[model samples]
Target: MLLKTFGWSFAVTAIGLVAAVFYGGWTGFGVVAILSILEISLSFDNAVVNAGILKKMNAFWQKIFLTVGVLIAVFGMRLVFPVVIVAISAQLNPIDAVDLALTDKDQYQQYVTDAHPAIAAFGGMFLLMIFLDFIFEDRDIKWLAWLERPLAKLGKVDMLSVCIALIVLLISSMTFAAHAHQHGGTHVDKAETVLLAGIAGLITYLAVGGLSSYFEDKLEEEEEREHEAEEQAKRSGKQQSAVLLAGKAAFFMFLYLEVLDASFSFDGVIGAFAITNDIVLMALGLGIGAMYVRSLTVYLVRQGTLDDYVYLEHGAHYAIGALAVILLVTIQYEINEVITGLVGVVLIAASFWSSVRRNKRLAEAEGSTEGSGKAEVSSGV
Candidate 1:
């Protein structure tokens, strides 16, 4: 099962290692290895959240996710996306940006880092909404009942998630702006940019998610009509909705997944700069890590891991909430990547164990009930 599932990931890892060696000798290989591990550690929650969405999709989309999606994840976001950010933010031509990356890596890193406020504003708000919506929405299963239950109750307030997110962005921007003004800090100009970027992020989230829902509804309507016309006599009011145009749906989903990925990678890409400003090595390393993350997403979907571990999604969203808040804070200050990565990993790991314990308890109770029923039967004999 492992081999069949992760064969592609293993093959890609081997190629990445070989390429690293060829590109920069053994030192390059070591850098990519560390980069890959760093990406995986930082993105484990990403896999869980992704699986939740991917499973709702059909088989064709899932295959595309594993195949073409990996390419976009590696080259597009991990490589070209950062370059584009540099090119745009630095007001340099693409060629100049490329040159900066190749000839003067530090300059390239600075441009990308300089764009952090916009990145943080957009990504932080989008991610914050994701966390807030997840926590605030009603669910039968919850991981941190103490925290989540209250949020769930509060979810009844219309637009509560968006309101909370805006309030956070407002306070963060005002506070940071004030501090920057008082201290003559350079990043003070970020106040206005943060709000604008955050709104853009929120809009993007709404548009993509809304489009997906609209198409899904259309697909469902089409399915229901087909059932009524053809199978009405055979089966009653039963329908399994399928994508009307597999190709088109796959295309949109591909785009949606890429956007979602880019949001998640914002922090990772920035954090990589903290380690090293070598864009080439950063791309190669983070790219390899992204491939593994895609593989893990597929694994979770195929194995039905989300269904097995009910609280896994809750934990992943909670981690996202932490990261979102951290991103906003990072707009004002530097935070150690280790702390950020650890917070996410720890939340997910703790949730995994909680799930395991719950499963064991349920199994024991079930076994005892079965034993009691059998005893009654034997006594009658």
Candidate 2:
């Protein structure tokens, strides 16, 4: 099972390291290794969240995710995206952007950094919407019951998540971004960039996420109705089949997953500059990390890990919320990637332990109940 799940990731790692060594020798190898680890650490929560969505997809769509999706992730997010940003921000052509990245890396890095305000705002807002929708959702399992219950109740209010996201965008833009501009710490138009980018993020989330959810719910409803009709037919005699996502529903879900990945990668792309400005190395390292994340998502689904550790999804979303906040904060202040990575790992670890404890308590209670029943039977005997 392990081999079936992680064989590709292992192969990618070996090949990636060999290529890294060939490119920049030991230093290149070490940087690639660190970048891979960094991407995985910061994205563990991303894997968990991805599993939840991926599990609902059909087998065909699942294959699409591993194949086409992987290409998009590796090349589109890690390599092409940064270049595109540089091209637009630097007012250079695509070829010039690529040339600049290879020739004048410092200038490439600066262009990428200059684009941070808008990037952070867009990614942060999109992730914030995800966290908000999750927390506000009324679910059967509540990891943080005290807080989640209250928030879920408030979720009944129409457009609550959108309202709150807009409010956050306004505050962050007005205070941190605007203050930076006032102090000459950033571009004269930083606040406007943040505001517009944030609005775009919010809209993207609503359009993509909302459509995905709508279609998925519609599909589920159709399935349920068909199942009920089959049961009715079985009164006379018949059979049937079902699927969670198909056709339009699956397509939207696929699009949503890609967008979610893009949002998550924004920080990693920016942070990679701090380690090295070599775009090839960043792509190789981050690409390897991304493959592992995809593998982990598949493993979790096949293993039923989420079903066993009920709070894992909750922990992941909390981590995502922390990340969203950190991204927004980084707009004004620099945040260490170590802190970002640690926040996710710690939350997920805590949730795992909590799940263990819950399982133990339930087992003990069941054992005691069985013991009492046996004693009563013996007394009767």
> Top lDDT: which candidate number?
2
Instruction: List model 2 lDDT by residue over 248-275, tens digit each.
Output: 5677667777777766675466545444
Model 1, global lDDT: 0.72
lDDT of 1 by residue, 267-370 (tens): 45644544444667778878878877887888888887656766666666777778788777777777765566567668777887998999999999999999
- TM accuracy, model 1: 0.78
C-alpha TM-score for every candidate:
0.78, 0.76
Model 2 Cα displacement at 318 (Å)? 1.5
Clashing pairs in 1: none
